[model samples]
Target chain A: MKKLIAVLTVLLIASALVFAGGNGESSGSGKKVVKIGVYEPASGDNGAGGKQETLGIQYANAITPTVTINGTEYEVQLVIVDNESSNDKAVTAASELVSKGVSLVLGSYGSGVSIAAADTFASAEVPAIGVTCTNPQVTLGNDWYYRICFLDPFQGTVLANYAKDTFGAKKAYALAKLGDDYSVGLCNYFIKAFEALGGQVIYETFPEGTSDFAAYVTNAKNGGCDVFYSPVSIEAAALIIEQANTQGLPMPILAGDTWDSNVVLAAAKGTNVSISVTTFFVEGSTDKQITDFVDGFKGYLASNATALTNNGGNDEIAAVTAMGFDAYYVALEALKKAGSTKGADIQKILPGVTYKGVSGDIAFDKNGDAVRNVAYVKKVDNATGKWQFVSVQSVK
Target chain B: MGFLQTNLPYLLAGISTGGQYALIAIGYTMVYGILRLINFAHGDVFMCAALMVIYSASYMPLYISLPLAIVATGVLGFAIERVAYKPLRTAPRMSAMISAIGMSYLIQNLALYVTGGLTKYYPPVPFISDSIEIFGAMTKRVTIITPFVTLVLIVVLVNIIKYTKIGIAMRAVSRDFETAQLMGVKINSVISATFVIGSLLAAIGSTLFFSNYTGVTPTVGGMPGLKAFVAAVFGGIGSIPGAVIGAFIIGICENIIKGLGWTTFSDAFTFVLLIVVLMFMPTGLFGEKATDKV
Candidate 1:
């Protein structure tokens, strides 16, 4: 009799736990709900950047809670999932959003995770809008993935030119993390561009989970290189920055879009290291739309402690957050244009949808990539821990 | 002179990293000496110490928080053994080992939940974090401080084992668990002491290690923990000095390999060394030769 009771109690608790995970299909307020899946890394190499991106979406959702499609007011609900900044986890996270039956998805701070989940979204017929994923392969052949950020090829060339022209650097040392698609891909593009500019380039790849970058920095310094470039994730970037400062690296450091983060700023602050990165948007822009975003996003971040911590313990706005804010509005525009909440319907109209975002005017080309040409180059001011605008770079 | 100038930084980093590994290896070696079970959770315990310092330092001053964190980690280690291992004392040895692995994951997952998977930055220590010049090569002062700290701690630990009553009880218990128990050696207290000492060393190691690296994630301890385990095996699991020497060699070699631009092979080299050592010296450099019982 005791054994029977024990088994019955166990089953009851298990069933209760299962039921606790409520379905998103039903709304208690008697309103039609349109779910937008948020696929971002909340915990991994890209977790810091991912949270800031998600913050933009959350802020956008808070301000515009509903979208009027055709004559009905449909409530917009966000389904957020952490991709954990890994390829295998990205597929699982993508499938989870698909299973949640999201009408459209906005996501993914890192290009590697975005590319990893491309096929999943393609098969599910769900359209995903990339926020800050800069790798070109993210939307190359996958009709389902649409990105708002500029591709790596442009960003890489811009940084390489900045190195050669601004710093007068002739020899460049480029380092990347092995197996990380974003760093390796961006590093390759930078190398190609640097070499094309009649500069000598030496490159090396560090394995993942590498906390010790002393040797790599020493190699760069000892190699008699004029400039150092390592377009890596925010995590590795911080460690490398510290090592660079410790080693008293004489040459300036260069990186791609991933370095345009407050995490990078915080790490490079108060250090003697010089860091420059090309990114989508810079904070404190003179444009009215960007100013509004900077003000409102700062207010939103200040209101929530968790959001502030996720923003690297400050109210400083990151470029990815602005892109995230823009990605959310773009999803809404696609929904409004399509006039339907089905994944297939959104996919059909995404390529035709264009919205003026805080970053810039967003319009997709035939490859489902944003038709962006110019990138903002910014340098970290080590003294004040602020970003100083360097120049607006564009490739002819 | 040119070769030395170019490779000096790598050698320094290796020695510093080796010192940190030695501190963690001692924890593995000491626990293995008594329990004969690999406390896989030792690495997690080290991570917990770092998290504790990072979180506590936010509220209290470093002087108070640092020691408080180390003491709290020791308590956590004591609690883990009592909860996970003590209940299964009479069970098969494999069960205890499995429990250790489970405890490791449990602590890591708990840390992940608390930090929300964000990499928490380790607050910089004043003197140790300052940059210093060693033979014209620039590096953190912790590189110079780590070797001395590790040696001092080892000397104190060795002296305690050589002189103290509790230390003698621990040795007897490790040598013969049943005989020591029959002789009223108070087996549980000795076991608890072993855990406390090991955890305290791991805590200290975490301080020196993270002072240089400066980033503390939930899974940060996994690699160092694995490397330290290999160090223990290479030096003979139950030998303390052997583990220290093994850790230094591995640390230096790994960094020198990175200097050679073989960064990809550095981690793989540690395992290759382990396999070679096992094949040639199964008993390890300082390990006692085992005799079969009739």
Candidate 2:
């Protein structure tokens, strides 16, 4: 009886191994499915970001040409991999995508993951187009890298302009999560810009994970700043804003696109002071292109068997849909111009192709950054749970 | 000095965080002192309590949510001891320890898979986010609530172990399970009760932790769990008071490092303290010597 059980166990183990091996090799040389890899946190704190980026790709593929990369035609496919919101996972995902023979990859909102996968993409000779993942090092140190978004310096200057001219705030306090590259980068950039604009950053602080904010809020109250800035997660932002409201602290809080979430609105609502955020798209806007993208994204989601529309995700989907549409069509237009799927061929032709995208007309600079549209700031209406357009400014 | 004064609230916040770690550490110390097998899965017990708090808060009022979560955690601790533990009571100590580690991984992964590893934000309470000022220092309502609640819990736990009948039984079991069983003190029941008390404390810790942290993730308990374990060893693995002291020390030390502008060193600071303590005192600050029936 024991021998029989051992045999069964071995067989089961063998079968499991076989199934795992098969799953990895299932994509045959069939229809020219161009497996584009995605590098984003499919789980953890930034899970929403992964879905947002991928969902954008989905809508772009739906509306754009059948296939185009460097002026050549080929069916497009995206092999989604979850970075689990860790840099280690990003490296693993990049390697896996390379092995799967993907020529292009999209991803990685934070600088850490982009850096992690830099060598992998470079070694594989595949291009990585970063979406809103801005830090100077993301594209500067690597050859096979590009980004559709502006860097921290640009974002910082835009925000500083709003603080100085828009809000008329001359003094501010900055609280940054020193542990993260994104937070530190954004904080430094904002301080430089704000200080240059003659606004004093009176006080600055950093704390570990979602701890009580009363002390910090009180400190901000003490510093007597007209504005308080924390480039933090939506979860952290909500708690801090809620506590700030509770303390009757009257400083206006300013932050990056990280503040663009329904939960932030939910937390800030009914509080004495309204929280404002900067980001790419505002959901409740009546702009023709903005509404068109939202409607198209919802339509695409409704048709796709696996598309999702929950957890304040439609807004996220709308943002990505715009980005993805730009990426896909740009690649297709490039492919038609190149008349080949070869990396070398397409790389040469990419500098010449131009297409007016959902965000703006896409044109790559010599350094490989898309010099497209500007980023806008939005305010959350606590009662309506919608984004109200506040202002638009260029990162440059 | 200006930076320190400006960031003093972060340090104070760290102290309150240390207080929560103390509560979780006590549970680890109490369990380890008697069993000599690390309750590796203690953090999951803490996570379960937080889950219970969120789930129960939906059905019951917010006031009742904490107690309900504590009770649920205690019940889970008892169940874990009864099912996964009791069968290995006669097994080798290493086997039990391995089982404990395996159970920890199982619980954490299960939570990760089920919760999709996302950070779940807690719905704000009516008056919980309010802040109070002391000596010109700002204290959040939850911080004030947490420290006082933790102190009260420590007192009650101390009283329960010092004067109660179950306390005597637990002590007897810790000394020698065989001897205690021979003396007609139900070994399983006493151990079960000990786990229950430890879990209840962990539950309270979790509730307080989530109240301040505002969100719970699969890996949220990882740092706290490992830190609480280090606290247990620092205080004396089997010593309850030792664990609490160890936790507070680790917490305070981490904050001091963070306050010093070496924020990247925050994760490593506590472990460095542990290594220093172990180098000087191997038995842990309060760990006892127990005989093994070889």
Candidate 3:
């Protein structure tokens, strides 16, 4: 038995040496590889949204496999790490990316986790371009963090305006998830905009893991609000929609980009409440770039059922996916302009880097936030339970 | 009338949530009663039941799927006992408990691997999930039926424990494990039977609980499980009726606090109740004082 165990250990060590040699020989054969890290939650509360965002990055990588820097072609390798949608885990995942020596980082669907890892990225001198994390604090103090999506203040204002202008709502009720930075920040901005528009704002919050919304819906109904806005996680949104429908609430439901999920859409199906949200990208656009991208994305989904499953098992192009795709391209553009894979070089050229992505024109402000003002307003048709493009609103 | 109208829905919601907790707490109380060990894996067993329903319900209808899931969960509970606990039965009690905690982690990680840590939507049952109005308060039919079903099951369980030979053997074992073994009672079968009953209740509780929540994540059972364990401790660790009452009080008070806009303190309040109960009455409301043989 001892001899057999010794023989097995020898075999394992021999195979390990052979594999290491093979890896070295393969890497030495060709082009230089630059790693672009993807730090997203593949598990935990934000897992669903994180997976969708990764889908976009994966698609973008497939389309543009390599980037040219100083007339030398370098293969772009994506180093994906699951943050587990937790603040503590985000720090570790961010460090892992830094240790991988990535040129640029893209990711993190939730704002709270992004802000948690902001310090790690900064300390490591790694620039991370957020995909859909909308909280202002994610990029406010963290010079290493940049986003390709609009901040909560802009999206919140657009939502408030849509509620006032489209529905002519006077009284608005805002519901937010407690302790969630994205929900709380967006809800606060929405309240400010609604109050500035001379509309009465009623706000309520539910703690994390709250499964029931019956009482909250009843309160909203009793308050006689014209519009109800809840920028919460998809799980909470589903409960809210179902309870609101059961209670026979008449008011229209409004939310931020996070509400633009197939899960939310499936929940709101056959409900009395007409749901609308301000998102980054609206599918079926006439723009050649967007149309081509959508077509290509559909083809990718057809060939890859696993990606389709990650995207809620359909071809519906989620807004976060489009943002993720844009963030990857923008990172590539920054890398190209900087002519170096060093983190500081990418950060130096990231502000001036502009790319007309599939979503929209991507550019950043001094605060390292996306400078775009346009938000695509999509409404779920109560009859068909499908999303329909209403109009694009620009926030000042 | 107006005050009652505003508060009636919250009260009903509390009762339903309480019923779910009571069902799960019964499992905790029963296992603690028999083994004098806190079965930390009880919550993970509840989680496994829900996951079983999620994967099974896709291929089969609830009527067929529900029973199969319950039996499978029961078998899993039995298997866990045979593998993790039965070996350490003669060892120190602390060893069995540590094993239970380790088993909980193993089960949760196993579930995470199987589901890939994705939250799957719980398929809504037709008749049970339908909403009905009660005194101007609109709630699901499951809410009204939960407490009734829990009470009926409690009565049936009590009868089983009091009347049947297996039940008498169980009582004897809980009273004195060595004495019961010396009296020619089969210790292994009775312990297996205890796990079977506890697991069955957990399976039923998972069905009712997830039906309301409508989404099953990997850690879905953690909070409910902790709260249920607290409920068991709050009532009296070995007492069934005590667990049920403690669960209702916790559920109602927490919901009322949430309604009053104190959401953060609502969960914190359960632990506060437990601490107060421990300080004032260390053995719990229905716990019998045990004197160790020095």
Candidate 4:
């Protein structure tokens, strides 16, 4: 009986490991395959955003399945790894991509994981194009990491300017998640820009795994702030929106790129609370490129139930997804520019590679950051459950 | 009035969450009373109840789905004991505890696999999820209803343990596991009954808890589980009333701290209370003094 139990335990563990190994095999196709590693969190706080970001890359891959390098056509296969939206897991995820022998990498919607995996990519000489990781630290001092989205400082200032100029706010309440690189970094920049505008800013941070935002929302309400800003994960954002709406919070809520998601819209839909965010792309754009991508992406999502659910059960295009699509094309551009599958060659050629993505014109500056200044501010249309483009703003 | 207006929201939130924690804590306290082992998986059971509702509600009516999920959770709790803890009943106490910890991880990982690590939005239960005002402060109707729900459940649970034949058998078994078995108390059934009742309360707790919090993740149970465990220990691990009171105190204090702008230390405060309680009163507030029969 004891031996039987031991065997069962061993079998359970063995089966678990096998299940965890998860679809790492490459295709046995006739064409030459060039692997592009997708290191993003498919689970955890940033899972919703990361999954949508990944969907964009997947959609882009489906649309452009092959890329030519040195006049030879190679099948573009994505090697996706879930960093679990944790800094600790990022190293392993990055190494898994590195070990997979990917030519170039795209992704990591959260800046914390992107920054965490920066050293791993740098050490492996792998060039990573960040999809929507907006923290400046993601690319600062890390030559191997490149991001398509604008930095937190730029996003933060744009939001601050919008809050002051639009809301005519004197005092603002800012809440961020403790120890979250993206939330804290963006909150700090927002505070700096808000205070610089001669506006009083009250900043507070809640610990991770905090389900209750009642106290924090009450703090914002009682503090007599004119505008409330919390640049947090989608999971936390939903809870906050619920709490804010419940409390009849008087002020409009402002956030950075993270809040520009279907999750936020769903939470704030048919609610009295006001929410606005600065992001890369707005869905319902008349721009030919964006319109084409949106139509194609929605159709792609509709065909797959899993992808549609991962996109928060709708085809509403998130800005991160748009950036993810752009990031994929940017990586392909790098591979084409280098004309080689070598990581070192891709890294060297990445600084010069440019592409006119659906999001915007993506060109890498000397610091390997996107040379862009303008961001589109979007407000949640509560009645419609869609994002309404307010205006395009830039830092002077 | 001004002070009440400022602090009432935090106090109300604390009480609501405390009641939720109380529901979970009773499970810990009761299992510890009978088995003398910490049912670490109790929190995951609470989480599973929420997940069950989320998944079931997609296909079935809310009323049917809620009851079905609660019943399923109770069954899960019963099966957990039969599979994980029952076999190790004769083994060393530490072995059952290790199994409990293993079971906790198993449930969390299984949940992770099923949800694919996505944060599932808890479908709002009507009426209870409705936003309402209390003394110029706003919160869910569930918040006001939770403490009463927790109290009523505890009263019913206390009476079952005090009066029913199975309750007498349960008390006998908790008082002396081997002796109760020798006295034909049907120790196994008592243990199973304890798990079912504990799990039912946890299910109800998850309902109220998720209505306020709403975002249900795979590992969401870990914090509340640990907090509920602390509440059990703080109140006297074997005493249900003690656990409930301890949960409320921790809940209120934690929220008050957050209201004071010390959000980082809210989680830290629960552990600090545990250590302080352990240092001064080892057996907890209502725990009977340990006596050796030499």
A1-396 per-residue lDDT for model 4 (tens digits): 999999999999988865653443335676888999999999999998999999999999999999999999989999899999999989999988887778888989899999999998999898899888999999999899988888999989998999899999999999999899999999999999989999999899988788989999999988999999999999999999999988899999999888988999999999998999999987776998988998898899889998999999888899999899999999988989899988899999898999999988999899999999999999999999999999999886
What would the TM-score be for candidate 3 when compared with the true structure? 0.94
lDDT of 2 by residue, A1-396 (tens): 999999999999988854552323123655455666777775765665555666677677666626744444456766677777676677877777777666577777566678788888887777777776777778876656777766777877788887887679988877776556777888899999999888898544554443445556766676668888887765567668766765667767888866666557656766566677667654555778767877878776666545653334333343444565566666666667767655556667666767776666677777667675567887767577666778787644
> Number of clashes in every candidate structure?
0, 16, 0, 0
Task: Tell me the deviation in Å of residue B201 in model 1.
Answer: 0.6
lDDT at B282, model 1: 77
Question: Runs in model 1 with CA error above 4 Å?
Answer: A1-26, B290-294
Question: TM-score for all predictions?
Answer: 0.96, 0.85, 0.94, 0.96
Candidate 3 lDDT by residue in tens digits, B77-192: 89999999999999999999999999999998898788876778778888888878777777788888899988999999999999999999999999999999999999999999
> What tier of docking accuracy does candidate 2 attain?
acceptable
Clashing pairs in 1: none
Chain B TM (all candidates): 0.98, 0.92, 0.97, 0.98
Q: Which CAPRI tier for candidate 3?
A: medium
Candidate 1 per-residue lDDT over residues B218-268, each given as its tens digit: 888898998998898899889999999999998999999988878778889
RMSD of 1: 2.2
DockQ for every model comes to: 0.79, 0.32, 0.50, 0.80
